[model samples]
Target: MDSQTGTHDDNMKPATKKSLRGFAAMDPQRQREIASLGGRAAHQSGHAHEFTSEEARAAGKKRHARAQATGESPRA
Candidate 1:
């Protein structure tokens, strides 16, 4: 379960395995509001730290190596 939003556990399920039927059931305005609220919340929580392009590339390489060793992609 998503502790942050009380939504279904998307992390536990593969993206391709999930259906968008429920997502389409929601109001577009409501969805936009929810996404905007989440973005603001994340910004307020100091979660959007800055990372230079070089740093990001280095991190990606390290993450790829780790994923290869563990047989799983690294989480965002």
Candidate 2:
């Protein structure tokens, strides 16, 4: 039974539930270590995106337009 909702899911086994919650139950340091490994692998595999100046300028313009429409100030 779920403690928060007082209900149970019959389809999921205990091990499955534990595995699903495994990553989030890890410490902050361990989480960052795993994330860093993935980032390094992505860069090494030539899948990381490096934005050009024109692309960055377009993105900034879009953000500024959205902020102006919403009456929120854009960041520098």
Candidate 3:
């Protein structure tokens, strides 16, 4: 019997994939509203990992605060 054709088990466990359970469980209309409000799109689309509107605003606020403390304009 060829080694390649042998029935030996490889014994490797299948990898667990990441899931978007919370977001995906929302109603379709709610999902669409979130999307329209700049929430991340579902799945691993290029835009999926991006910040939502509230997150972006919070980040901007933090950046502005940091810039002010360093005596620099936030625009820069």
| Best by the TM-score measure | 2
- The residue-by-residue lDDT of candidate 1 on 1-76, one tens digit each, is 6889878875596457655676576899988988899888988999976789999999999999999998896874
Spell out the clash pairs found in candidate 1.
Answer: none
Clashes of each: 0, 0, 0
Q: What TM-score does structure 2 among the candidates reach?
A: 0.57
CA lDDT, candidate 3, residue 17: 85
Candidate 2: worst-modelled 10 consecutive residues by lDDT: 12-21
lDDT of 3 by residue, 1-76 (tens): 2379866556756579877688798889998898876644444456656579999999999999999999999999
Regions of model 3 farther than 4 Å from truth: 1-48
Candidate 1 segments whose C-alpha is farther than 4 A from its true place: 1-25, 71-76
As a whole number from 0 to 100, the lDDT of residue 43 in candidate 3 is 47
- Could you give candidate 2's per-residue lDDT for residues 1-76 as a string of tens digits? 7889988879766664445377888898999999999999999999989899999999999999999999898884
lDDT of each: 0.84, 0.88, 0.79
Q: What is the lDDT of residue 34 in candidate 2?
A: 100
Ranking by lDDT: 2, 1, 3
Better of 1 and 2 by TM-score: 2
TM-score (C-alpha, index-matched) for candidate 3? 0.37
